[model samples]
Target: MNQHVIRPVRADEWEKVKELRLAALRDPAAPVAFLETEEAAVGRPDAFWQERTEGASHGRSARQFIAEAPDGTWNANVVVLVEEAGTVGIFDEAIDVDQGHLVGVFVRPEQRGSGLTEALFEAALEWSWSLEGPALDRVRLFVHEDNARAAAFYRRFGFEVSGLVVPMPTDPSAKELEYVFPRPAAN
Candidate 1:
């Protein structure tokens, strides 16, 4: 377990970002943790990666952070999506929650339990909390029901189940649970 410097994704590093995403998709837990498959990701064009990375990294509505090991290898990543007051969930329910939706969470298996995940979460949550007044009141993430490791990590990080479960769009027969961490009013 090495110390990884967690920082916002750089605009010029889209290629590396694409590589990490594809690697994550190839992980054994991809079926439960990620919607994208290796085959599908590998088929994407360079422009897609460039646009996706630039938009996500520099876009005001969202932010993506990456963890890079001392050797220059990416160890993990997390992206935060800001949900506005009148937005709606994938299920079409009004997204009155006004929250930060965490997505694209991944930690390389070799780096698991090295505290890098916690550091990544801290960086992400700090960014989410740093938003302007009335920007975002809470942070939420969906965890597949069978991904107990992720659920446990969320709980350890002070997140609690919101009692909302949505069937995964990629696999309607499967379900995922939404966990949330409300920002303190004083934040």
Candidate 2:
């Protein structure tokens, strides 16, 4: 709830980006909230971070945003994966939906209940809706079915389950639920 600023990721801040990602992976909920483990993330070389940030930062459709505290640490982050029309894999790939896939959403525990999540969602979805040409029809995110707290939060934020379940890529036995928020008709 402090005066943290949310903005698109800067091209040169790959180091901070890497640091924040590692920090998120270390969070207690990382098992359910993130796909990559701390070991996997920390093992990546500097080159990976450089390319990752450059690609998303300069991309026409996808983008990453961070909430930075005044002391220069990132309090939270969100990445919007844009799925253009006629594209598959946007929402479960097999379904072929025109939408924006929201992923890699994380907020530090200290910042969890201070409206930061909602603000981050607002920024990510706003960016998704503002895409030109083929407008994104919906915005969606995947949440582990076992993560009840996350599910509750998503529901409060206006996302409803699409009833589409996908196995976790890392652990095929577990299923993750897909939640979606359709773009407002008048918007």
Candidate 3:
């Protein structure tokens, strides 16, 4: 396994962020794992990328973490979004409590099974639980029903199926399942 450094993305690393996202969109599992298309992402302007990076990098309500290889290449990334109570979530469900929503998870083919994914989630969950003003009650993620690989990984990470399923916005014939990691019990 290659050595990697896992860290939160910096606001100025918009270029690297954009590059990694585009690469993710090109992966074979992208269609089922991500809502965005490579075409849409490629058509976006630099300003959009800059704003996105800034929001995830500097905003208190969200964060994007990346695993950088020894040579400085980003091989994996995950974004966590804070959902406040009483708000509508990405799946159109009402948020019942303060929570963290994990999204945009991707690891390069070469880095899969190297423990990078676990490390990324560890950092994200730690950050979510450590928030002071509005601590999260749980961290959640949506996985397409057909993406068994992702679902298994999530389950292995202690995220249980929440029994809430939603139709894919772009393709209602398909569905996504909600998985959640409830806040760990206080020690």
Question: Which is the leading candidate under lDDT?
Answer: 3
TM-score of 1: 0.94
Scored against the true structure, residue 58 in model 3 reaches a CA lDDT of 68
lDDT of 2 at 112: 88
Better by TM-score, candidate 2 or 1: 1
lDDT of 3 by residue, 69-177 (tens): 9999999999999999999999788999999999999999989999999999999999999997877899999999899999999999999999999998878999999
**After superposition, which runs of candidate 2 have C-alpha atoms over 4 Å from their true positions?**
85-92
The candidate that wins on TM-score is 3
Question: Is candidate 1 or 3 superior in lDDT?
Answer: 3
**How well is each residue in 41-156 modelled by candidate 1, as lDDT tens digits?**
99999999888888777655788898898899998999998888888975555798678989889988888889888888898899998888566889999999999999999999
In model 3, the runs with Cα more than 4 Å from the true position are none
- Please list the C-alpha lDDT of all candidates, in the order they appear: 0.87, 0.86, 0.95
- What TM-scores do the predictions have? 0.94, 0.94, 0.98
Model 3 scores a C-alpha lDDT of: 0.95
